[model samples]
Target: MDPGGEVSVSEAPSQVPPTAMGGEEEEPGEQEEEEPTAPKKSRLEEESLRAPMDAAEHYVELRAENLKDQEPEEPEDENLKDQEPEEPEDENLKDQEPEEPEDENLKDQESEEPEDENLKDQEPEEPEDQNLKDQEPEEPEDQNLKDQEPEEPEGPEDGGPQREALDFSHTPQMLTGSWAEFSSLPENYLKGCKWAPDGSCLLTSSADNVLRVYDLPSELYAPCWQLLPEMSPVLRMAEGDTIYDYCWYPHMSSLDPNTCFLASTSRDNPVHVWDAFDGKVRGSFRPYNHLDELTAAHSLCFSPDGSHLYCGFDKMVRVFHTERPGRDCEERPTIVKKRGVTGIVSCVSFSSSRALYACGSYSCGVALYSCQDGAPVAVLPTRHQGGLTHLVFSPDGTYLYTGARKDPEILCWDLRAPDKVLFSLQRNVGTNQRIYYDLDPSGRYLLSGDTSGLVSVWDTTHCASYRSSEELQPPHLTFQAHWDCTNGLSVHPFLPLLASSSGQRQFSWPSDSEDSGSDTDLGAPQERRQENCVCVWWSGPPGASAPGPEDTEDREPAEQEVPVCV
Candidate 1:
C-alpha cells in the first residue's frame, strides 16, 4: 500500500486480497491489520511508497502537456476559407477561338468567285511581232548554226559502236608469211614478240641477235597478208650481242614515231634504249659491282610511266632512270633473300599503279618493294617446288599471278592476304622453258601458251569464285595455236586480237655427249629443229565462210610425246 491510498502494483503478491480494487469488502481481521500497518508503518516504508505515487502523477501531466504541444497551427485570416476557386484557362479552347476569325476570312475568300471570273473575261494581250518573227525564215545570220556541218556517223571500223564479245567458237584466222618466212634463216628462232600499243606494228626479237619491227596492214580482214618488199625491219642489232629481253615504252604510239623507243638487254652488254624509227641507240645503262665485274641483266621491264627501268640479275635488281639512261645505275642493287634458298632473281614485274614492284628469284620467293623507298614491303614465298618463271599484276593491282617452271598450276595470290593462295589454274607445263602469258586489256581473261602448242583462255571471275566453292572449272576456251611449243604470247591493247610465236628448244642427249667417239655418227652435230615462226590471230566473230574443219586438223598431241626436257 502507498501512503496516499494509491496501490503499488509491482510490490503486491501474486495473489492479492479480494478488496484490493474496491470490488468487495475485506475480512475483518485482514482489514484491521492492513489499516494499522498503513498508518503506523516505519518512516523508510512510508517514504518509498510515497515516491512511486508522485512519479506516476508527474508522468501523466508530462504526457498531457506533450499532446497539447502537438496540435497543428491555424491561419490567422479567417475570410480565406469562404472564397470560391477560380477555374484554369482552357488552352485548346483559346486556340479554337482565335482560329474562328481565320476560318471566316478563308470562307470570305472562297465565296469571292467574281474576281476569278473577271480574270477569265479579260482578253490576253499579244506581243508586237512574236508571230511574225516565228513565221519568218531563219536567215544564215539568225539561225543557230555550226561553223562546219556535222560529219556523218562513221562505221564500226571507223568510230562506231564496239563489239562486246568475241567469238571463241571458231579458230582465229592465222596471219601467215609475215615473220614465218623471215625466221627461216639459220639460227634465227623468234625469242620474244610484242604488238604496238596502237596495233600498227609488231616487234620480234630473235636469237640471231636481231630485232625486227614489221609494219602490219591496216585492215586485218584482207584475204591474205602480202609481204611487201619495202616492209623491212626498222631496227636491228649489231654483230656479237644477242637480245635476251625487250620491252616497249608504255607510252609508245605509231602516230608519234618519236615516242617509239624500246629497251632491250643483250648478252654480256649494257641495256640499250633504241629508237624504233631510226634504228639508233638512244641510251645505254650498265650495272657494275665495286670490283668492276659486269653483270648481265637476264630480264628487263619498264615502269608503267616509263620513268624507271628494272633489270633482274642473278641475286639482285638494278633500277635505272629511263629519262637519263646514259648514267650508270647504282653499284649496290636491291638484294632480297629467303631461308634455305639461294637468290637468283629470274623475273620482275611492276604494278599498274607503279606504287610497288615485285621480283621473283630462282629458288627464293617473290619480294615486293615500295616504289617510294625501294624497300621490301612483303615476301610471298614460292608455293610450288619449282622456281617462278613469270609474274604479272592485275590491272587494279589487287592480285598477282605467278607461273612456276615445271609446275602445272598458275597461282593467283590476293595481295591483301598474301600468305595463302587464292586460286590455282591448271595448264600444261611439260617444258622447262619460260612460258610467256598476258592478261587482256580489260583484265577479265588470262591467256597463256602451253607446251602442247595450245593457247588457253581462262575467266578470271570464275577462277576467283574458288574462294566459295571446292571444285574449280576448266579454262573457258582452248585452241591449237602452233605446231610446236608456243613460247611467246601477247594481247593487242586496243583490239580483240592475239599474237603468238611457235618455237621448240633443242637439248643434247647425255648419250650423245658420252659416246661422241664411240661412233662416227655421234660426232656429227645434230640438226636443231626450230618452228621459228610468229602468227597473228583475229579474235572477232567469224563469218559464214570461215574455215572450220581445218581448225582442228592440228590438235595438241599427247604430253609424253612432246619433246620436253625432264
Candidate 2:
C-alpha cells in the first residue's frame, strides 16, 4: 500500500501548527490587541540575544508553544496503520447460544505459541527485522511508582514557585495516534478487557454470560471471542447470566489458582463474586446500598489478595470487606456517606497494594487522593478535549493510562516525577458512552475496546525518547498502532495476551519474539508529518517495577461510608 494514502488512527497529537487564516486586513490597533504578550521593542535585543538563557529558553519555548496543537508523529514512527476493517467471523459465530460454545474453539482462540506467529513452525521463520515489520510494532508503556525517583519535567506556563504543589513537567513525550477505529461502539455502552501478563492471550466479557479469549500468535489468522458491542450496565449485568463488568484477577503475588475470582456487580445491585472456572456467583454483597431501587454496583474491583472488594455506584465508591470464610463486612463503606465526591464515581483503583485509591471523572480530570483521607492529592488534567471515559494507573503506580469520549485515544501520564503525557492511543474502543477500561498487571501496555468493534493497543516506551519528524526510520516508530475499535479489551494478568471485545467477538496481539529495539533515537523535526497512526517500536531498558511489595496493609473497621457530596 502507498504510505501517504494509508488511514492510521493517531494517539496524541504533538503540536498544532499556526493556522494562517486567509489574510484579513485588520486595523493596526486590532491586530496588536489580538496577539499575546509580544516582544517589547527592547533596546536590549542584542544583549538579550547574548543572554545565557537564550539557547535554553528558545528551545523550550518553541517546543512549549508548539506543544498545544502538536498532532505531530514521533521521529521513530512505524508503518502506516489504520487497517482495512476486517470482517470478523464472530457475527456468524454468535448464532450459537451461551449454553454451549465449542470448548476446543475457545482454547484455540486463547492459545499462542510465542511471537513467531508461524502456526506451523515446521518451516524456518523469516529474518528478525522482516518479522517485526510483519507484525504490529511493539513498545513498552509504564507508570512511575512513588518509589522510583520522579522524572523531572517542564512545568505549565503558570507553573513556578507560585504553584509549588503541582508536579508538572516540560519534556512531555508526544503520542501521535491511537487505535480509535477499533473502539467505535454504539452510543451509550459499557465494557471491559484484560491483557495477559506474558503478552499472549486476552479475555473479555461477551455480554452473553460467557467469556471470550483471544490468542495472537497465529497472525491475522489468530483471534478470540465474546467480542461484543459495549452494552449498558444493566444489560451487561444480565449478559454473563449473573453480573456485569466482570474481570480476571492479576497473576502476580500469592493467590489461589482455582479461586481466580472474576467479580461482578449485577442489576440486583449486589456485588457478586464468581469462580472464573464455572461462572458461579460464589458470594454476593450489598455493601452500602440498602434500597434495591437505588442500589446498583456498576464498577467492581478486588484487592490483589481477593480479601476485599471495591465497588462504585450511584455517586459513591464503597468497599466490602470479607472476613470469615463465607461472610463480608456487614457495614457499608465509610467514604460513601461522608468525604467528598462529585457527580457519579465512574471508576476506582488501588495503587501500591491498596495504599492509595485513585478515582476519576466523577469530578472531572483524574483525581489522585490518599485512600486514607479521600482528600485529593493531585488532579491530573484530562488530555482530551472531551470528558474522561476511564483512567488506569500502571502496576508499579508510576504512570497512568486514560481514555475519553468523542475521539479514540488513550493517554499516558507519569506521576512519580513530572506529570506529563507519555503517549496516546485511539485504536481500541474500550467504551462508547465514553467509559470503561482495564490495565495489565505489569503496566507496560494499555488496551481500550471502543464502539468500532476493535481493541487498540498503545506501547509507550518511546513516548519521551523520540522527536517528531516525517523521515522514515525503523527505530522511531511512534504512536502508530491501530485496528478496529473494539467494545472491550483484556490483557492477560499472567500472560502477554491482549484481547479486544468487538461487535460479536475479539482479536488478540501476542508479544513478538523480537526484542523492542536497540538504543539510538532520532532528532525533533522543524516540520511534523501527518499520518493516520504514527507508532514506534522501542525496547529501551525494561522499566523496573515500582519499589516495594504491593502495599496491601488493610484498613481498620469503619462505621459507615460517609459521603461529603455524592
Candidate 3:
C-alpha cells in the first residue's frame, strides 16, 4: 500500500501472475482446465498478499475521518474569527513591559477631576450610612430598655422590702365568732369544702353522699363576725355511693357556671364530675387495673389549666383528659410502688407550672414524676414516721410540702434536692385524721388545722429560708378555732378570710348504768355532736360591735369552752 496516497501498489499490473500477463498465448482446452485452479490459487495468494495493505488503508481512512470531524466548525462570531492569534513569546514580552506610565496617566486623570463632584456623589450616602449604623445600635438599646423594665420590677416584687414587710411578727386576729356556718344533718358531717376561685360560692361534700354548692349573699363581707342567716345550699346532688374525696375545678368561677364543675370519687364508683350550677353529673371516669379490679380514685386533683384530671389510687396515679372523659386513657398510671415503696397513693399534687407532679404515699414517701411519662423521675426519701396525708407544691413549683398522719411537722422539700429536707413546719397534729392545711396567696403564711381544735399559722418565709439552721419552726400564731377536731382548713381565694370545719366521731357510748342498757344499745342514738359545722374567720380589722358568747349560746351548744387567744 502506498502510505500517503489514495491508490495502493497492490493494484499495479506487475502484481498479477506472469501466465495471465501473456494474454493471447493459451489454447481453449488448456485455458478451461487451468481456469478453475488458476482462479482459486490466484484468489488465495492475492488475499494473503493484500491483508496488511487492506488493514493499513482501512486504519488510514478512519484516521482521516476522525480528524475531519474533530476540526472546529467556522466560528459564528465574525469578530472572534477575525481576531489575531498572538504568539506566546510576544505575550511574554508584552507582560514584561512597564505599566508605570499608564498608571501615572490614570492617576493624573483621576486627580484632575473635581473633588467637589466626588464629594457630592458620596455626601448624600454618608449621612444615610451613618443613620443606619446609629439606628442599629438604638434598636438593640430600645429592646434592652424594654426587657429591663419588666425584669427590674420582678426582683423588687419578689425579694424587696415590700415582701419582707408582710408582718409575720403580729399574730393574725380571728373573728369573735363564726361569721357563717353551714350545718349538715346529724348523720352526715362535712367531708370537704373548697372556696370558688372567684370567691362567689363555696362547694362542700358531706357523708350524706351529697355535694352542695352554697352561694354567698351579696351583703356578706369579710371581718364581720355577726351571724348571718342560715342560707340554704343553692345546688345539691346526691351521689348514691359514699363520697371519699372531692375538689372544685381549678378554673371554676361563679360567672361561668357552665364551665364550673366539681369532681368527686366514691368507694367503688367512677369519678363523678358534676356541674356546680345545675348539680348534674357531667362525666365519669372509671379506671380498671390488670387484675380486672375496678380501681377507685381515692384522691384526685385537676391540672392548673383544668385540661387534665389526676386521680390517685392505692398504688398508681391515673391521668384523664377532662374534655374527653369517655375516651380510653392509653397512658398507664404514674406508678408509685415500683421502687419498693408500697402503699396507697394518699395524696397527689400537680405542680403549678405543670412540669412535674408529686404523689404522696401512705408509706410516708413522696414520688416525683415528670408530666411526660409514667415512671417516677425521683423518689423522695421518707421523712415522716407516719403515713403521708397531703401533698402540695409551691407557686413556683420549686418546693413541695408534705403532711403525714400523726406527724406534727409539715416537711418542705426543694424539688431540686429531694433527698434532703429543706425545712419542717411544726403544727399540733396528733391524730390520724387527714388534717388539712393551706398556703395564703402571698405564700408568706401557712395555716393548718390540728386535733386540738386549734388553727395554727406558720411563717413560711422563715420556713423557706434555705439558710435557716432550724429543722422546724413553731407556729407564729395559734388560735382555738373549734370545739372538736378541726379537719378542714382553706384560705379564701382573694380575701384575708379563712374557712374551717370541725367534726368528731364518738365511738364510745356513755358508761352510765341508765344508758348502758344492753350490748345492742350500741346501735341506739346518743347525745348529738354539736361541733359538726363550718366556721368562717375574718382576719381584717375588728368591728366595734362584735358579737359575744351570748349570741352563739342560743343557736348551738358549745363543744368546748377554751378561751380564744387574741
Candidate 4:
C-alpha cells in the first residue's frame, strides 16, 4: 500500500455520475462527445471504490462493466434489428423437432381409445353375467366368492391338482360294487375316516389305536372294471392310546414331501405330526399343564394356510408354530376372567375368507375368535342337547354347521343372524361319538353318517333359512352304508367321491332257547354280523366319468361348468 502512488481497485466501472465537465460547452455535435468523456471518468472513480471487494464480487463487477461497454454498441446494430427477430424464428423451428414425436404419441393414444373402450366395455359384460348369477337365489354363493378370492397355491390349474366338478342333481351311482371295502377285523373296528387334502388317498382310524392310509382304487378311474377286491392299507401308524383327533394339513400335496403330513392327537400322547408319505412321526407338539406335566390335546387342526397348528385342550387352545415343533406355544385360554367356554374343547374350524376361527366345547358351547390375536369375537348361545363334538363353517363363511355327541340333530346356524337355528338335520347318533359331516366343495350338498349305518345326503340349497324354526329338513337320499354304525363321512375336496368308515362296539348274547351244540351253528346268526370297514363311493351325477390320469388326454377341455342355479 505504501509503494503504489495511487490506490488500485479491482472492480467494475461504477455507475456513479462522473464529476461534471464544468467548463465544457454542450453544442449539439459536442454533446455526444461529452457523454463519452463522462463515462470514462466514472470508470476511473469506480476502480478506486472497488479495492475492498473479494474475488467473487470483483468477477461480478467485471461482468457488469462488459455489459456497459456493450450498451452503446446496440444502436449501431439497430439497423439490423429486423433480421435479428427472424433469426429467433429459425431457432424456434429447429427446437420444435424434438416435440414432433410427442405430438405423434398423443395422436397414437387418441387412436387407441376405442380398443381400450372396447376392453372396458367387455369387462362390464362379465359383471352383467355375474349379476345374472346373483339373481338366482338357489345358487350357492361360494361359487361367486371363490372366483373373486385369490387363487390358492395348489389351485386346479397349470398342472396343479384338479378336482372333478360334482353334481348332486340326481342320485350318485356307486363307483364299483359295494363289495369292495377296506375290511377290518371284528376286534379292531373302524372308528373314523378322512380324505387326504389332495383326494388321492384316505386315512382311517380304528379301535385298535391304529391309523391306516389307503390309496384310492385305480380301477374306479377306468371306463369299465370287474368286481373290486378288498382294499388294504398302504401305510399304518400305531398310537399308544385311542386317537382323539386327526387332521390332514390343509395344504398337503402328494407331490411335495414337505407338505405331505398329518397331525394326530391321542389320549395320553403329545400331538404328533406324521409324514403322509411314510408312516413315521415327523415332529411332536407337547403341551404341559399348569403343573408342568405333559398333557394330551383333545383335538388337532392346522390353520388355513398351514402356518400354525391349533390344538384343543381343556378350557384352553394352544397354537404351535408349524415349522418349530416343541413345547413352546402360544396359549389362548378360553376362560378369561371366569367367563368363557367350559369343558374340553372338542373341535376347531377356520373360515377361509374371514379372520375368524370357531371352537366347539364339550360343555355345549361354541365360540368364535379372531385369528389375528385370538381375541373372542362372539360366543354362540348353547343350543345342542349334548356336548358339542364338531363344527364347520360353510365355504362362504356365512353359515355354521354344528353337531354334538349323542345329539341326533345337526344344527345349521346363519352367522349373519346367530340368535336362532336356521335348520336342523336329524340323524341317529345314540352313542357318545363324533358323527362327522361334510359339505361338498360347492357347499351345496351336505353328507353325514349315522349310528344306524346309513349315509344321508341333503341339498342345503333347498334347506331354506327359517325365521321361526319350523321347517324340518330330511336327507334327500339315504343309503345303507354298512352293516355296523357308520360314524364318519368325508366328501372329497374337489372330487365326486365320498369316504365312509363304520364300526362300533357290539355284543352278542346267546338265545334263551340255547341249543347245546346240535344245529345251532347251522342256523342263521342271532344279530347281523358287524361289518367293520371303510368304503368309498362315487358321488358324481350319473354317467359322469371320473377324471383320471389317463382320461386327461382323451377328454376335450371340459367347458367351465356353470353354477347350478335352481
Candidates 1 and 2 compared by TM-score, better number:
1
**Residue-by-residue lDDT tens digits, candidate 2, 420-485:** 565565443333354355654444444454454333344445443543222211221222122223
Q: Which candidate is the best by lDDT?
A: 4
Residue-level lDDT of model 4, residues 1-566, one tens digit each, is 56353333423323332323323322323434465565454554455333424555889999988887877445444544555654544434443577755655664466566556666878787888899887865555665555533223233232122233565554444432122233324456677888888777889988888888888777765665533555668899999998899999998788889988999999889999999888999999999999999999998888999999999999899999999999999999887665568889999999988888999998899988889888887778756889988888998899899999888788888888877788888788888877888987777888889887788888787776444454568888887766567888888775567888776776554554556544344333234446566766666544425433342222111121111111
**Candidate 1 lDDT tens digits, 369-450:** 8777667778775676578788999878998998877878788888998877788777888766778888876677888888
C-alpha lDDT (0 to 100) for residue 230 of candidate 2: 22
- Tell me model 3's lDDT, rounded to 2 decimals: 0.66
Question: What count of clashes does model 2 give?
Answer: 120
Supply every candidate's count of residue pairs whose N, Cα or C atoms clash at under 3 angstroms: 0, 120, 0, 0
Model 4 scores worst on lDDT over the 10 consecutive residues at: 557-566
Sort the candidates on TM-score, descending order.
4, 1, 3, 2
**Tens digits of lDDT, candidate 3, 94-170:** 43466744644565467544445666767768888888888897888987666443212222222222222233343
Cα lDDT, all candidates: 0.65, 0.42, 0.66, 0.73
The alpha-carbon deviation from the true structure for residue 28 of candidate 2, after best TM-score superposition, in angstroms, is 99
Output the lDDT of residue 200, model 3.
69
Report the candidate with higher lDDT, 1 versus 3: 3
Best by TM-score: 4
**Model 2 TM-score?**
0.43
TM-score of 3: 0.62
TM-score of 1: 0.63
